[model samples]
Target: MIISRTPLRVSFCGGGSDLPAFYREHGGAVLSMSLARYVYLSMHEYFQSDGYILKYSRVETPKTLGEIEHRILRQVFEDYGIRGVDFNSSADVPAGTGLGSSSAFTVGLLNLCNAYQGRYEGRTTLAAKACEIELGKLGEPIGKQDQYGCALGGLNFIEFHPDDSVTCESVPITQAMRERLEAGLVMFYLGGTRSASEVLRKQSEQVKNSKRALGSMQAMVRQARSLRAEIMSDVDLIGPYLHEAWQRKRSLADGITNPRIDEAYERAMAAGATGGKLLGAGDAGFLLVYAPDEARAQVCAALPDCKAYDVRFDSIGTTIIYSD
Candidate 1:
């Protein structure tokens, strides 16, 4: 048996710029951090010799890799020539909550498959392979941030070059600053699950037509870089910086925010949240906010409909937790 665990991520700024539509021409960057929450994957030999059993929110028994209904599992199993195995998965958060759960799942699965195959690849290779499976093979209309974020497992500034190369640099934050940042930040579940594909697809198409939108995305990249630098010196800058990024983010696509999200943000701001934004590609998921000590209560009280989470940053990336 083999089990792998990976941390989900919270992207602070710079999102749309990572899409190939924009980055292939102008490059991109995102500042994000992994949380203690994780997606866990476990695999073992199946009792049956000629079939595979998979379990998650649902169960599937397929005689062939091609017969698997889950896309990432199917691709990973085929890539590794894995069969006659029973695979199970569990997570700290559900998918589509804007915490990069899908990428964490992919990274964890790849890590488990590598261990099962006795391959000792590092985080970089694992991230690259996962990206290849999701982006190059599956053709997901997403950016490279999540894969790298889940694999690297720290506060990072990730850069996506036009040449399709990615680089992750740890944010130079002091221990005190890290604690301060974590304390002031709050995540509230705004409900509903959304597949980022449609919004991302629309944003991708619009980038080619709207220079203004593309420019805004480019500016976001700069914001990501600046935020990383500024946060090291003063964590308090994050709130206003997040606000600035959020303003530009909503402009990239029409469906990124809806009436409910707008009302929530208004309420949060009224209650003392310095700034905040909907996590993920928008429409639904968690709403992340920056509220200082005095404002935290009011902010939480204002969002009566949303569930709150007190999550801390995680430094370890994906790891094989159990094996035999």
Candidate 2:
């Protein structure tokens, strides 16, 4: 049996820019950090060995590689020539809640498969393979941020170049600053789950035609750069920076924010949140906020309808937790 775990991420700023539609021409960057929340995958030989058994939110037993049901599992398992094994997956947070859970799952799965094959794939290659599998192979209309962020683990500034190349650089932050960030960062479950594809698809289409979308995303990339520069100088501009980015983010796409999300953000602000943004492709998911010590109570109390979480950073990207 082998199990691998990967941390989900919170995209701090610069999101829409990572889409190939924009980045392929103009390049893009995103600043994000991994959260302690994780997605885990476990694999072991099946008792009967008549077929392959897969367990996640649902269960499946497929006799052949082509018969595998879960798209990611099917792809990864087939590539690794996995069969006659029982594979089980689970997560710390529900999938598609905008914490980059899907990519984390793919990364964890890749880690597990590599170990199972008695091969070692470093974090960068693991991330690259994930992007290849998710975006290249699966044709997911998403950006490269999540895959890199999940695999690299720490706070990072990820860049997507025009030539389809990418890079991840750790933002040097003091432990005191890290703790401050962890304490001030708050997340509220705004409810429901959403597949990022539709939203991202729309955003990508707009980037080719709408200068507004492109401009907003480009500015968000600058926000990421500014944050990276300013963050190291004993300055915490994250809250207000998020505020600025959120303003631009909503304008980049139609479904990025809705009435309910708008109402919640307003309420949070009224309760003293410096700034907050929706976590995922929008519609529904968690709303992340930065509220200082004094306003934390008001921020938590104001959102009566949502469940809250304290943000903790994850440094290790993906790893094999147990094997026997």
What residue runs in model 2 are displaced by over 4 Å at the alpha carbon?
none
What are the per-residue Cα lDDT tens digits for candidate 1 across 1-324? 999999999899998777888888999999989899999999998999799999999999999888999999999988989989999999998899888898899989999999998998899889989889989999999988889999998899999999999998988788888888889899999889999988999999888899898888888999998988888888889899889999999988898999988899989999998988888898999989999888988999998888888758999989998999
lDDT of 1: 0.90
TM-score of each: 0.98, 0.98
Q: What are the per-model numbers of colliding residue pairs? A: 0, 0
Per-residue lDDT tens digits for candidate 2, residues 154-179, read 89999999999998899988899898
- Candidate 2 accuracy as TM-score: 0.98
- Lowest lDDT 10-mer window, candidate 1? 303-312
Model 2 misses residue 26 by how many Å? 0.4
Show where candidate 1 strays beyond 4 Å: none
